[model samples]
Target: MFVRSLNNESQLLRKIAEGDQHAFKIIYDYHRRAVYARAIFLLKSEVLAEEVLQEVMLKLWQSAGKLTDETNLGAYLTTLTRNRSFQILRRRVLEAKTEIELRKDWTESHNETEEGILLADTQKILADGIALLPPQQKMVYELCRVDGLKYEQAAQCMNLSVETVKSYMKLALRSLRSYMKSHTDLAVILIILKII
Candidate 1:
């Protein structure tokens, strides 16, 4: 049975490499849920996870010609998904909002000043901390917080159950807490960790 499945997958992969859109769609539809699950796991945001899934699929299609074997297609796809998801998370961290006080440093008639540069550095730190969160936690947290989706909504979007979403969110919070411990106070951490 396993061998037959493997053969079928190999044939599908060969068809995909030959620029068969239907074959690519079959492969994508089969793996889309797993890709989203991984993205949600790493990113803590449903919206971002969805975005990552799209990006991953697009890249996969573009690189179909390079798929040599299907015996480990899942692993290869997972690696690609992880790399892209991390990229999104890292970009989010690098672009975190500035501290309110720092924002005051910028004027309508803006001046490029040393303070602006320092503010940018702080934003980068916040972004890095966010990027450090475990993949699943990041997706759940982001969906709830950044995207303002309720747990149920987020879960639906991620093709996960509400309980699973809650579980993921809990795990994400714990991991983020640990990751950001050095940079946060108890009160602020509590605020961020609050499940809504």
Candidate 2:
């Protein structure tokens, strides 16, 4: 019975790969709840889990053509969810560490006037860079980086998944770095800001 069920799933995958939207919907309906439950269990955040669910489904749709009969859909989706969750966690840790290092460096610097001037300039550049971000990214960056909210807090405030928050922070930092690099000699300050 187990092997038969596997065979049926494989057939469904094959049909999905052949551009059968009906098969895809069937598979989605069958798996989405379990996938969502797993994501919530692993991430402990409904918002992030929902985001993961959407991302996982989008991946399934985009990669349906590449799935072979041997592909284990459950395992594939599970692994994707786990990987994405870990990625968000890792980014949060790195951001925290960078923030700590920046604070320490800033506090220990003796050249207060020079550092102040540079920071003021960097803040202006940052504001300009932030203006270029999409609204969601800008809000996420402000809540997490500017307002010093934890990921969970920011997620709650923004009504976003932690993963989505992290993704926005990543994009915002990338935009800031590109902008700062091009506009000023504050490359060192940019490094200190380290939005990665």
Candidate 3:
């Protein structure tokens, strides 16, 4: 029985070396369990283990012509599984180290300039909001808010009565408040992406 099995395996390997898909499928069915079991046991992650299994199978097919009658299939798969598992573990360690270093640098940079960045963002949003006002409202906002002029001063500069300037200022403030509120989410997203 053992001799018959050896002959079967040798024949399957020979056919796989000639690029026979049916032979490769049979070999895959016979060996996939050992490959997957070893990978899952070592990696402790089903997803990564499945990845290793596919990689090993692909390697096996690619290197099928190297197989000889005396080659031990189980041991060959074991070596491949162990090597690939270690590679994943090494990559994970490297990623963790990189993440830590990046976080440290980002935190330091953010701490030093976070307030300035936020103030700039707010000013931009406020400027955009002001630009959305009607021509008269926009003029009133620039004169009163941007230039720091009192309502009466703005009124004289625009050649209008004090009451009319006050009314325009109120309308501009209300419109700007609504515009700023609507744009808050966009500003927040920009800030978060920049920080990250």
Candidate number of the best TM-score: 3
Worst 10 residues of 3 by lDDT: 1-10
Rank list by TM-score? 3, 2, 1
The lDDT for every candidate, in the order shown, is 0.72, 0.77, 0.79
Model 1 TM-score (2 dp): 0.48
Which stretches in model 3 have alpha-carbon errors above 4 Å?
A: 1-7, 108-196
Which residue segments of model 1 deviate by more than 4 Å? 1-6, 97-104, 107-196
On lDDT, the candidate that comes out on top is 3
RMSD, each candidate, Å?
Answer: 14.0, 9.1, 23.7
- Per-model TM values vs. the true structure: 0.48, 0.50, 0.53
lDDT by residue (1-196, candidate 1, tens digit) is 0111334677787787788989888888888888899989999988788877777777777776777664477777789889998887877776664545466775667345854664555455456766877777778888887777778678867989989999988887666556556775564444444422
lDDT of 2 at 19: 81
Candidate 3 lDDT tens digits, 111-164? 538767776787788777777889998998888766666676678579999899
Better of 1 and 2 by lDDT: 2
Kindly report which residue pairs in candidate 3 clash with one another: none
RMSD of model 2, in Å?
9.1
Summed backbone clashes in each candidate are 16, 0, 0
Instruction: Select the stronger candidate by TM-score from 1 and 3.
Output: 3
Predict model 2's lDDT versus the native: 0.77
Could you tell which candidate, 2 or 3, scores higher by TM-score?
A: 3
